[model samples]
Target: MMSVTRPYQLTDLSDLMALSATTNCADPRAAYGWLQERWGRVAPVELEPGVPAWLVMGHQEICRIVRNEQLFSRNPHNWRLYNEGAVSPDSGLGPMMFPRDNAYFADGDKHRRLRAPLDDGLAGLDKQRMSRLIRTTCAELIDRFADRGRADLVNDYAAIIPMLAIAGLFGLGPEKRHELQRGLLALFGSGSDSQAGNETVERILTEAIRERRAEPRDDLTTAFISHSNLANDYEIQQSMVLMISAGYETTKTWIAQTLRLMLTDTRFAGRVRGGRMGVDDALDDVLWRDPPMANMPARYALADCEISGQHIRRGDALILGFAAANADSRVHTEDPWLEVGNRAHLAWSAGPHSCPAHRPGRLITRIAVDTALHRLHDVILEIPADQVRVAPSPWTRCPHRLPVSFTSAGAS
Candidate 1:
């Protein structure tokens, strides 16, 4: 531990790297390595420009912070900068970092209370029905471009399937589903349109809640509206927001990343095509190497403490470095044989706030990947892997586009 502990001054801002830039870089692992070498496990970083926070990179250190709620809380209300009125409502971080009524921003009993509706709503999901919905959505999406013999998988396929399937569960029609998808993409992009996007999402979800209350149906929206744990309309809407945004972004990224891996890495491509390794193996491998939610925001320190020799002040924000922790050399190795079937990565996160939708997320990703690979013969990236661009955001590391060419019956 390098015991350096004092409040950061404005002058210190020049030295801190923006967290978003690191993850958006060509080699994030190298960026993480540079941070670790310079500042040990916990390194100082900026969310935007002067908005400072610590990015926790060590696997053990992250486990400690997440597992002990007493020391670190998920509620963003504890964030010093936000409480100090430093973060503007119009800031790009608003959609992601601001406090909300959902479980993602609550702590203790309230967290469990808000989380129940999501847990129950998802648990009540008809797995077979959901799978069928996903498969059907996949086929429909592929048919749109299958005839052209080429497609941008990220936009045309990976991005659309998750939202469409999720909307199907909400019993939304095509118009509303498309509306919801557009809103969420802008919201997660965390750009100038984020606030507007958020408003659109809230409005759509609010309408769903109102309809469900008036005439309940056999859908997740109705299930959420009727869940015993949800107390009021606000809670219900926020819960849906959390479920849809989190599920859509993460699952979309998982599918894109897995496809990228299978298409780029001959180890996976040959094995998967040869029946030596399963698609599940490739999915699991992506979780370890490139999790959808590369850096999760965030946990606030409840009390001043020391971690990895750095003095963490009370109310300081700590971003969970999932991608970095997954690469922790102490827990991971370069040996490909040893990595197969390994489920030790922090991609799904850990502790109470760990992703509750893992089963459904995996189910969705697996079906989407399997269906695409099987249907699109000889699918291959149109550009070099290094040329692929990732969407710019403070939290997730998703590809912006994945253009590919393949053989189809309609291609003459």
Candidate 2:
């Protein structure tokens, strides 16, 4: 275990905390090095006003906690603060930390049971067919704004593709598809109505569940409804909500971030000049520096344990500092350009609860970026790279808008 210079402090815990569910989430980079200098790897901190948890920044330490399900659990119900009634149910963090009936909040056998349907659903997808769908979808999205020679790539392109594709997979039509997209975007919450947005998404998904139950289709909703583990309609609805939210937000961020990287980063010049990187390289870089989910919330310590010299009490919540952990000095190098193919970053997390949709997410992102770069000539960021505004979320650090200028294909 590493030695700690100062013990974790709770003074000013209320003032120091920030909500972890918005684009406005605290930048881990700002405090990662500082925390490492003092508290070493695992540092104690407040998740919100009067809500405390450990921020695990060490790469190895995060893996240890994620993999050891017996020692640590994903169930937020185990959280001492929530269980003790310190973190109120109506808090902004409720959307993330509060318990749900889905696989995201389950543990052990229950987790496996809930997760199996999701795994089976993703596995059942035809890779070539999905790729074709993404390619066609990207082409159409590009065509919509290609003539303008400028567009908000985040909203106009990256944001729309994943939901459409995922909705198609779920056999939903245009009405439900658009509603799901709107609900999901609002669920990420730039405004004060995040809880309402959460309710909207649940209501929409519940309706979809009911519709699928009455008229079965060859889709994910059908699969969830029929899955043996999910016994009730509410369970099915929750599972669908999990699938849609997970698929939608994560992919949207991944696509937007990768596109942002390609346009702004000099290394990925998009045309392979000298050692200019490709879209896949940019994708890897995003996973390392700015993953879709910067910090995943609420893993409770099953019992008293020490991780990398930080003492964690039983039922204490630990935030998997994915962005911070990826930059851990011990495992990750200081120079980003040095390790080209190195993929040790914990972007999709580790252990049983690791992202199940990573494969499809990568495929969608790769195709979106590839098609956009090829279809649009000489794409460049409309705003200065540093000035690009991110949405207000504590967990995800996605750009709110990625406006860019490009030569029209006809002009080129």
Q: For candidate 2, lDDT tens digit of each residue in 1-412?
A: 3457866543326334343532363455766666666677777666766777787788888998889999899998798778888977668788778987889999999999989989888887788877887787788778888888899999998889998778766767767777777777777754777668778778877787888889997778888787888889887777777877677778889988877777777765544334466667778878988888888886898888788777788888888888888877777566866676888989899899998988888999999877887788877898998887787666788889999888775321
lDDT (C-alpha, whole model) for all candidates: 0.85, 0.78
Q: Which candidate has the highest lDDT of all? A: 1
TM-score, every prediction? 0.91, 0.87
* Residue-level lDDT for 13 in candidate 2: 63
Candidate 1 residues lying further than 4 Å off, grouped into runs, are 1-11, 186-203, 333-339, 409-412
lDDT of 1 at 329: 82
User: For candidate 1, lDDT tens digit of each residue in 95-114?
Assistant: 67898878888899988888
lDDT of 1 at 156: 94
Query: In model 1, which residue pairs have backbone atoms overlapping below 3 Å?
Result: none
Best TM-score among the predictions, by candidate number: 1
Count of steric clashes across candidates, in order: 0, 11
Model 2's C-alpha root-mean-square deviation from the true structure amounts to 3.6
**True lDDT of residue 27, candidate 2:** 52
